[model samples]
Target chain A: MTKRITKEFADLQTEPPEDMKVDLITENDLFKWVVTINGPKDTPYAGGLFLVHVILPNEYPFKPPVINWKTKIYHPNVTNDGKGTMCLGFLRDGEWKPSSRMAAALEYVRQLMIEPVPDDAVDPAIAEEYKNNRKQFFKTAKQWTTTYAKP
Target chain B: MAYTEEELAQYERLSNDYVPDAEGPLVSPRQSSQRITSEYAQADPVYVHKTTTLPQQFSQYRTVKGDGNCGWRALAFGYFEALLQTADPSRVLGEVARLTSLNNVLDSVGYPRDIYEDFTDETLQLLKSTAATLPVHDDGAALLASFNDSGICNAIIMHFRLVTSAWMKTHADSYVHYTENQSIQDYCSTHIEPHAVEIDNLGLQACIDAIIKPAGIAVQVLYLDRSPGEEVNQLNWPAGPSTLNAPYNGLSTIRLLYRPGHYDILYKHEDIDILPAAAVTNPQINLMSGPVYLSSSNVCYSQQGLDIDNFYIPGLMSAGVSLAYSTDAYISNAIYAPSALPITSAATDPYSVPYSEPPKAIVESPTLEGPWNTDRFRPSQYQVEVKFRQVMPVRPEPCQTEAMKQAGESKAHFRNEDFQPQIWEPGAEYNVGRNSEPNRRRSS
Candidate 1:
């Protein structure tokens, strides 16, 4: 397992995704990863940095990693509570295949920032507001990004 | 009732997060397929009609859990089983060599060598190790043990998932039509690669093509649905044997009992010799689990349940029940006859209401087989626990054991062995001394 994990870690460090920087949370443990994803351009939260916690279960690769947004965001797919839990459709337990790549999962998270999946959202009310009232939703999202996600 | 926004989001989260709590072994011990017959006896008439005819063609089955990965697990277990059955180490070497060559496919299919090394290495190790233990005639026990261990089993199955994925990607033309609207690559990702998604027909076909066919193993899926039929619908890939030469001792085929959403391995008596260690410790598959093993035991534990269950043996009507008893295999299979009786005379309506008239089939005369020309159905003292009064036709009690003793005690020499004879031999020699006969032990 460490072989697979450290190999994945080495690959992530050497050639990280264009929008994301991934590193082990500490030098000692490989299970916890600290990730920083740049909000996509043209989106309301553009230029804002997002810190996400990626915790790989002991059954890594077999079981999926758990992700929580340490940096709050006003996206319908991400919960607005302090926990900020995010469940991308593919990352859900049933949908996560052992062959599913972490890089590809993060890409899905990145894509969600550009186009929130209002239909499959974690915060239904926020999703409703985003779908029915886009301009007002963008104003609050940008303000939240400025208040909470700015570096 | 409409849910509030908070409730709605919770519902969405719960649904997405829901993973079933899968029970039973990853791959279970092989069992009498008749357990399946008895399991469906009480269901609608169509199912009763189909499952009753199942064991006539397929005698045994090993259940793979209904867990999401059962399809992949079943195929993987079946492949290893076929290898072990080959009893030829070179088959393992050939598979290892073939799989190593498939590395070219895995790499070209866009999987990095590094990411897949763990799965590939694990798969190769098991194949090599299991074949090494062949001389012991472990009867696939070593293979079954490795499969039961989640760490080993999951890695091997993951290797299978990858091979299936890579196979589909490289050979897109044959599979392109089956992928529906999705590309072969995407279809493989969601269907073949996932640890949790059950295999659909295409995935079963691809895995069989990539791994099984090359090893010369046939795969048949018996669909046990309510489709109009006396038997389950069989789907065998490489319908006739493929170009790959059939191994001398290699499997005839790996049978899967596909009950719509799930897949379990089925074994014909012939398929089982190549599959599992004959019968292991689980005595539960006998009387406790279901009526499948109602094959033996005239000692009825439940006189009441006997009458009800006996009504459902559709196979009894196939050939005359008396005619069925003539076949030794059918006697043990009495096909779900827990409270089963051997009618001295064939009753026109054996399906008469349960517990009525003590169910006329129990032949009360000194011999149940007296009426039939075949002595195959003779009830002995061994089958005579008084608990079976209803099944034995209220025989005169004392004379029963005296006659049964000659039949039972003649061979009942091993005092310390199990109380019940492993396999009863009726009218075996009471004493075969040097003067009487020569010793002929069945030495393995």
Candidate 2:
């Protein structure tokens, strides 16, 4: 398990995903990581840097890692509460495979921001507004990004 | 958060179902027969049929827990068990060398040494120490305890998984067709290399062929499934050089019972009995020969129940009896001439005589002719007489000649080109060459 974690960590450092930066929470603890993703251009959350907490389990590859958004933003897939869990399909228990890499997983999260899935949403109200009132949803999403995701 | 009832239920089931406990025993003892009986006793017709045949076919089965790793666990347990059977330190040492060399395979596949080195080391260390203590009979319990250790067991399983997966990747063309047209890389990433993923048949075959068979060990997988068959299906690993050819010589067999989604170690009643020194001299011949009778015993009863008297070929029956008592020596002699046909009729006609009367025809025919005559002085002639009297009941003969003809034709078909032994070359279209573009994609 440590071997897998070390390999993933090295890979992450050497060729980190575009516009994303990851740091270990502490030198001794390889299990927890602080990741920041700069919202893609052309999206409402553009110019915002979103913080995500990555917690890998002891059985690193066998078990899927837990990723939570530490910075709040209006989105259909991310929960609005303090525990902003993202509901990505691949992270689901049955769908997750040990061969899935951290870089690929993080890239998937970035892609989700470009086009959020409303059917499988963590926040139904946001999903409904995004579906029924697209302009208003973008306005509120931009406002929240400015208020909470600055820097 | 919003989820449909079905999604919620699925999530609940996934969280509640068994997650393979790493600390659990690597291999558990054979559960009671009642465990299988209870599951199938009143269930589907297919299961009931399987339950009925299970007892006669297998004396007992030791299970590997339903952890997604059961396939790897079962194979590893089988490997150690085969080694223990040899009780030869040299063989264990040989295995250690073989495993060490296999690291090259992982390297060829671009698996970093740093990632898998510790696990491989743990496996090789265990083998080295086990070999140091030869005639591992006394230390059997301790050895099993070591296997139960989570770190050691998981490492060994992972090593085997990598070896199997590497073999598949290297020889991709042979297996890609079976993966529903998926490319070899896609198949390996999804099924073979993934941790906690259950192995499919192709992966199992690759493991047996690349790892176990090369170690000179044969595995007999008893498939207990819902297929419409009176007896369980038996597949020998490394599948013969050709389906018609016999398994590699001098290879000890490890029997595994395969259920729908799980694998367990199978034990024959004789496996439990302590063998005499003489019996141990040639264990392979003894083990392969026993299952033939065990499988046939059920077939005999079932055929009788179905009232299929004509299905019995006296010649084949006599050959089976002779092969059983005298071993392969009789088979070499019997293969020479088509004399078994005359012997079959001459042998089967005596059941009409009273038990008090000696089988005069059988005795007279063999003694009247000289040893040089093909009809006389065959070992099968004597064994068949004895076996026929003891086990065979009187039944009307079918067209024995026609049956023999069909059997001969089937044997010829097995020798056809389609059944030829497959040889995998590294640069073949199906195989992933070291310098191939796909190889570049794999590393990336």
Candidate 3:
């Protein structure tokens, strides 16, 4: 809807996808988008494509956007109950300034696909599972993505 | 964040002022001075550079020249050289390089001015005599168990800059205040205890910082308590926030402590039987002992104190018969001191450990925060400007017996006669001191 989001969407559309697809779930609303990201190369998550929903706020540039995996994802920050609330690590609660943007937040989630910050994470169960049983998390994430997001 | 063009230029100007010229004097005050310079005195120029001269050979002799604290430098070099002689051959070169640079502040000019004074020949002899037996190296732990003998073993983790940094961060508040206030006594009494705690807590990070970030030299943190165990405890061992995650030098720390009878520091090495004073072969305390103001012969002496005595006049000395005229320049120059270095001497890097060349500044490039914290490294920058200055002294009113009674120390009573020694006789005319009294006067 805004100039910055429009520009970001235009850029994402132009980039070629190796293992992921990013586009708006609802064609009329640009703020709610779907991103199907593949697991990083060589990681236990190899060949796994994970789908997530990204929700942009009304106060777009000032506040950070929220991204939740619609297709059951196992991560320290993401809850199993499907409540999309995730704490963005970069923004210190009392210390976060008004200048942080949405694009940066999205890019961090994209990076989370490759490496997970378990030390500074919130949900220990998922983090533990991700740590102790990496093969299982990759199998689950990939199966959910394939079953729920391929269309 | 970006700077405006004007702000950027201002930064450039400030940075440009810091680059030292190669041909300048070997010693000079690193900072500016204004009122401390009197019309009668002038400052000599000084220079700084790397020296190949081994410290052991120079232990017996000391150079009388330089601008700031020369005595401390001599002592630092003396002890370091002694350590090299006793230590394993592999540890010699690195320890020599480290100790030499650690005492860089002393090389700036005439420093530790208090010890430079012409005390009794006995004091001078004591200083020179004790040079041989002085312990110079603090015992260090081997970070890599297999690489024990090389100086780099424990030193790899014993980053002096970081240790100083931890000391500074832990005690920055008090040190800044005392040093800023120019009161060494205050620094000693008020700041030392808590300062020790800061070092204990942040030792690891401080060492890492010293080893890696060369430009940011660590502060010299001296501990009052001398037990290596106590020093280790005071250093707070595995310095914080990320302590458990990282293994620094095998077990993660080397402890420091003090040795008795001598006023120096010691460290315990794993194989060595004895720990000795390794850093300062001779520690000097610059203060007035008696009448003749003792200071380094080469350095300018700044005197301060109000001259209450109007002019050269007659006796407040004795209640005797028929006294004629007498002359004296009754001034208490003892209480005052000139700014030895710049008034602010601590700001310059307090200590510098040598690396072959200054480390190249790393450009900050954004990288995703990694899963684990990592320690960064940089080369040494020997260039430092001293800004630490002695605090002005405070003189309380002479507490008479009556005044002493009002306060709590009532047990040690004194009569008016006992208070006679405390009176301020305000003229130089009374040249004959109490010590030079005649036999009959003494008997009475």
Candidate 4:
């Protein structure tokens, strides 16, 4: 329900996660959220600012929110298309629980940037490149981050 | 490489319309038997076998709405139903106190007190009012009405879910092993705490341990899955010790019907005398006998606990099958005709095995006046009187030795001493460890 979402939004606002900022794009709609995550150091995305668009369903917590990468990134788990979709196992329809909050989802995305799971990757080509050619994978990822995800 | 459009469509249809047959009442009137053959007429061999055998063990069941919250709703309904059977205001008050105290567990588990307090308060208020009104109006109808109210019911059930989740979180070390290596917090957040999340075995166990066991109520979960068995597997949530080794003679127990993903309530015909008001008002027409069909659903108002004498013979005779009566001693006995019939009577098939001793005498005041008389129906040839035993409230003294007593005393002491709050220490090392775990896949 929106009540739980409002509580979660308030909780996140009071004590936002480290290096992450959350904002409502419109004053009327609490369902749509704009989240900004600071890429963890030591990853190819280090120093990059990735923006994520989160759209909560009417059945908010029961169904998982729809999340898309607004910023372009070259990651094994994230698609490099216009949608820039991220494949989070927990965010999948059957796997999502009402108790899982937007904060946890965002944190999971940050973790994915740090260590991409090549095994269950959305982008098959990127996954293959990451698994077989680590150097080239890191170079392209860093280049994409520098070009598209610059703060 | 991926699922075809047809496959995706099929999956969507299955997900959306899976429980079409689950549109019954939250708790339906008891049926004569489980209606096994009719219910599972379309089911496969495994379900059919289990369903057929279930009625042999359990006489009646109440269907619950197969909404996502069926598991919790079923358990809550069972808890209240069992509580009403006790008819003791003190027991209801005890539940209030027990539920109130669980807030401490929630507090320790880092659940914001303000967030969960209202839910708990709602539950406590409902219990208090129910207990307060017991002297004037104490019946299953009141309990059912309370449960049917979505606002009250949802609040109480949610409180229970939180309590179970908090209990699991508090006792994470014990439950973590059962989660296939998922951390306690993660496990609770995803499975136990969520609203509308169907309870798995571990979650069910946690609830039994936290709520039902402590409240001194036992529950038997009849598993009617596609398991190969003539008899359904029953898991008892024992009232004492909460261990497999403990003896299981609990004061009260309610039966739960468990299909693959849903749970509904089951009632023993002999245990509770008063049936739901709806069933009592509109008795289903029994085709075999003009007398009220003694199917599990027929609410016979008898104070003397289900009088086997009053059990209708024509119905059983018409079924033309010897029903297995699973008593404590004569579990192997293939048949038991509740009515007194000649050994050679059509009701008593050749396979009807007589018990060495009569069934245990159930102590209840014989109040209901019925049309059938034991004197008129008594067959001179065979007189094997079977009495269904009611679970006595007395605790077993033999099991409580000095060591066990000391252990029980120290358990309370250890609870305070060993209780550790699960606090996530936000430190650099913790972050590093989390980021570096390549092989550690998060459980979805």
Candidate 5:
């Protein structure tokens, strides 16, 4: 594989867009991706988008496969099936060894879409609307990205 | 408090007679059958391997205000020597020897710790919302009963230095003069009635609210003000005396360990005093001394999985993922101690359909009438048509093995009796006749 998708696409191009994001939804399946995040703009999802769907595991770079999120955005750190079932802190329990790469879970899910962490939400009602109605939870996540994403 | 059927069969025979391997069932060999893995070595195989085992029992409450002497064991030994000097002098000296043996069994059951300036602003927002729900491995009596169950009594370590500092300032007449002039029990008998009480109250906000209630972590206490050269205040840092003459030895001296939203780069490129006389960036005179608490717990053990990276140094990789749970519990107590066991075991299903169950029909064959039947009960179909005519072009001995080389072709190696429709009619009759030709030329 272009050596683990070119080092998680050169560490999603040297991290720091407040944290992470290794683009490429097309360029012929370096292993089916989509990415697009924003949220964590200081939270209550300051800008909110969060797309997600990376994939890659047919034994790529060996072992760790499964990164979800096809967009149905809400979190307790993800996992209520709008996909990107987010769970880092070591790509989640089994604690993902094999020196955990995917360019550090693509900069730990882009610093978890800029910290959508209400501790680690698996969706406690979007971690209690990002901990109690953060500006009408960013106006219902900008009206769920103009009604069901993919624009 | 449930477990009984002979204590869930002696905790399922001590959670299935030890299985962790990579040198862990506590130094292996308790008559080891190589620990377990012959498809989960039988008799009770439902998932569980390492076991975390919580509940060291809690429920012993007391938060009596001043004079009853509240220094929650010297403010939980000076907030675990300032959170073990911001991390990793050997994992904050083993969480400061597990919060100093659970604050010496709650200071021989006296329990009342120090500095509880009464409290209100809804008990200082329920002690900074239950110390932002503690739990990255809590034990110190559930972080002192989650700060005496939120209404916060004996304000242990001045309610975590007024909830990890930034000094809650919304002054609309100081939030109605500290909420209609103090009533969190007369504001802790009027401003912690002159400091000095029994401090060190162990129970780090109930181990950070059981690591934020099942990792649903929602900690958000933000305050920012008193700008200029960006706030590094630990009350003008520099204070070390007792606890073996403090200083790096008794830990807790850190002042500005950045990298969590880079605290607006020490308040936007440093420079303070934001009106009405403010101060706070004075860690022994403005910045520069580094290492005053910057241990973001190694980006929280890669968010707790442990592939390890980013330890600007706070308990370097959570003290190497908590001393890989006592050096190699097959990589952190067999993967973060059965997912930090609260009770998960339903046989660890997680989703349940992994190769569900339907596959036992291997080789039944009851209606076979022609592909070389040897006139009836298959005398091994004439040695499988002379071993498919001596392996026609010669390929399939499982494509020459190295464990089937890479597993392709699970079937079709040779079935082409010209695709099978001529049924041997032209050959059945002629074969019955030539069969006598000395067993077809003595099997060719």
Candidate 6:
């Protein structure tokens, strides 16, 4: 498992995916990683960075990494407060494939920003807002991104 | 989908109230499949009908816990078991090379050696150890123990997942028809490669094509469902590779009883038929080893009344219990080709109840109520002719010569209060000579 993690960590560092930066939290703890996804261009949340926290369980590749949003954003799929933990379909239990790579998972996380699936949202209020009122949704999302996501 | 706070609380309560689908060993020890029949004995009519007929074909089954890995575990266990049944050390020994070579398929599909080799090595090591117990005479204790160990079992299952995934990917054209809606790679990634996802039909077929079929193991799944049928419908994959001359090889089949969402291993009586050297291992009567035995198609030979610890197979022991089929059929065919009795003809009140119709031919005088009522019939060309009347124990006559006893049970031994002295009862409904000829049997 350590060998697998080391290989994954090295790959993430040398050939990182676009719009994402990943680093181990501490040299002592390989399981805890700090990741940042660049908010996509032309979206209301553009030009801001969003920090994501990831904790890989020892069973890893066999299990999925535990992830939460550290940066507050007005996204329907992510929780509005607390740990900001959320679902991305594939990362959920019973759906996570052991063969899935962390790189591909992060890539999926990046795509989540491009297209927030309001249909499967963690925040019903924002999900409803995103669906029912697009103009107000963009304004509030841009405001929150500017306030909490500027680094 | 998101839920309101109240809905979330209710959902939480519901989730808390729910228990898991299946819980037990990843794979369990073998058990009498008759237990399966009685399990559904009180269930819906369909289940009762299907399960009652289950023991007719499959005599035993080993449960695989319903933890969503049943299908994979059943086939994997079956593969190892088939290797044991093939009984050739070379065949069991030969699998390591065949399995290791399949790593090439894993490689071609880009499953990195690091991720998959750990599982592959575990698989190979298990096979090597299993092969060490060459000419497996005892019923697979070592194999069962290995599978019960979660770590070893999970690794083997994981290795199977990898192999199946790779098999489906490289053999894309073979499976493209099944995955027309999505790319084969997409289907493999989500369904075939998932550790938790239970195996679906396509995945099962790919796994068989990849590992089982090439190894000369026939696999079957008995779908015990609510579909219209007197017995469980079955899908069969006949014995692998025409070159592997395993004729009349019942043990090679990995019969799985699929009940909706679960899969359990099923075994024929032949599976429990111990090798001569290991006859003492099983406590059950060694029917095959016995010099004279009686069986009847009319009677449902059920072990339902067994005292788990001290139970004898019905016909082999003294007949304290009486069971009869509706029609007088070949006594041997019931034991030999148990599947021959169509569920339609065999009345639903199986096991203990007497069929409404009288037997076409009676082995013992139909009116015989005497202590020793068994008949001494002539042996068929294939085997000895003896019909089971377990209620009365067959006693050898003191005056009979040794040669007379071997050729046929001494006619003196079969006599009762009403035993007719004549060999052929002229114009009688029960003809002794015709009944003795097993090759020609009445349909009803």
- For candidate 4, what TM-score does chain B get against the true chain B? 0.56
Question: Candidate 2's residue-wise lDDT over B140-185, tens digit each?
Answer: 4545676777767767777887888888889887888898878877
Indicate the TM-score of model 2.
Answer: 0.61
Cα lDDT, model 4, residue B123: 76
By the DockQ metric, which is better: model 2 or model 6?
6
lDDT of candidate 2 over A48-150, digit per residue (tens) = 9999999887766556788899999789888666888874576754455554678878888888889999887766677889999999999999999999999
Q: TM-score (chain A) of candidate 6?
A: 0.95
Q: Whose lDDT is greatest here?
A: 1
For model 5, residues A23-106, the per-residue Cα lDDT tens digits are 767876677766666655455444556567777765443235467877765445666644446654556423343223566576
lDDT of 5 by residue, B55-135 (tens): 011111122223212233223322432332222233233332233333333334232322122221223333222222221
Worst ten-residue run, lDDT, model 1 chain B? B362-371
Task: List runs of model 3 lying over 4 Å from the truth.
Answer: A16-20, A91-103, A132-151, B1-444
Candidate 3: chain B TM-score against the reference chain B? 0.18
- Residue-by-residue lDDT tens digits, candidate 4, B1-444: 798644654465457435445576666656755575578977888877777767666677777777667888888777776655543334555577667778889888777775676567667776655544321223466667777776566666778888888898888776888997788878877776666667888988888888888766788898877777766788887774422221223546878888888888876754544322111111111111211112232222333244333343322221111121212222111112222222224246443444233332221112222221122222211233232111111222221112223332342332235534334444432445645443433321
The top-ranked prediction according to DockQ is: 1
lDDT for position B401 in model 2: 21
TM-score computed on alpha carbons, candidate 1: 0.68
lDDT per residue (tens digit) for residues B361-399 in model 1? 211111111112232232322122221233433222221
Number of backbone clashes in candidate 2: 1
Q: Which regions in candidate 5 have their CA more than 4 angstroms from the true location?
A: A1-151, B1-149, B153-191, B194-444
DockQ comparisons of all candidates to the true complex = 0.55, 0.11, 0.02, 0.09, 0.01, 0.25
Q: Which CAPRI tier for candidate 6?
A: acceptable
Candidate 3's error at B376, in angstroms? 63
Q: Candidate 3 vs. truth: CA RMSD?
A: 27.0
Ranking by DockQ: 1, 6, 2, 4, 3, 5
